[model samples]
Target: MSKKLRNHDEVVFEQLLNPEMAKAYLDVALEEYEQDGDLGFFLEALRNVVEARSGMTSLAEKTGLNRQNLYRVLSPEGNPELRTISLILHHLGYRLSVQPIQS
Candidate 1:
C-alpha cells in the first residue's frame, strides 16, 4: 500500500502542538531574526506558533485582543508594539528575555 503524505503546514502545526517543540522553534526563529533583521520572518514564525497552539480565536480570547487585530499584527507586514508582543507571548506560555551578547 502506498503511504499518504501529510501537508507541510499540517506537519509543522502538529509538531508545534508540543510546547517544548514550539518553544525551540520560536527560539530558532528569533535567532534568525537577530541575524538577518527580517521582521517578517519572525512574525510569520510567531503566527505559525499561534496557529499551532489553537488558532487566533483562542489566543484572542486569552489575550483579550480582537481576533482580526491579532491576524493583522501577525501578518507579514504587521508591526506589533512591544506590549502587544509581550501580551501574545504571555498568553502563549512564553515570555521575552534579554541576554548579553558574548564578546
Candidate 2:
C-alpha cells in the first residue's frame, strides 16, 4: 500500500475542521493581534476557519454577500466591516468577544 502526503496548507485546513482546533488557531491569531495591533491577522484567521467549515460560497449565502465580495473581504488585503465580521463569525459557530490583556 502506498501512502499519500498532504501539503502543509491541507494539513492546517484539516486542523480547522475540528471546532476546538479552529478556536485554538483563532485564539493564537487574536493574541498576535493584541501584541502587534494588526487586524489583518484576525481577518485571515476568520477566512481560514470559514474555508475549513462551509467555505466562502456558503458563508456568502449565510451572510448575504456576493461570493466574490466574500473572497475579497476575507483576503489579507481586504478590510471588512465589524458587522460583516460579526455575521461571519456568528454563522461559523463562533462570536467576537472582548478580553482584558494580561500585564
On a 0 to 100 scale, what is the lDDT of residue 96 in model 2? 89
Candidate whose TM-score is highest: 1
Task: Write the residue-wise lDDT of candidate 2 on 1-103 in tens digits.
Answer: 9989899889999999999999899999888878898878877988999988899988888878899988888887878898888898899888989888677
**Candidate 2 positional error at 53, Å:** 0.6
Clashes of each: 0, 0
* Candidate 2 local distance difference test against the native: 0.88
Error of 2 at 62 (Å): 1.4
The regions of model 1 sitting more than 4 angstroms off are none
Question: What TM-score fits each model?
Answer: 0.92, 0.90
Provide C-alpha RMSD values for all models, in order.
Answer: 1.2, 1.3
lDDT (CA) for every model shown? Answer: 0.91, 0.88
Model 2: residue 52 alpha-carbon error in angstroms: 0.9
Ten contiguous residues minimizing lDDT sum, candidate 1: 36-45
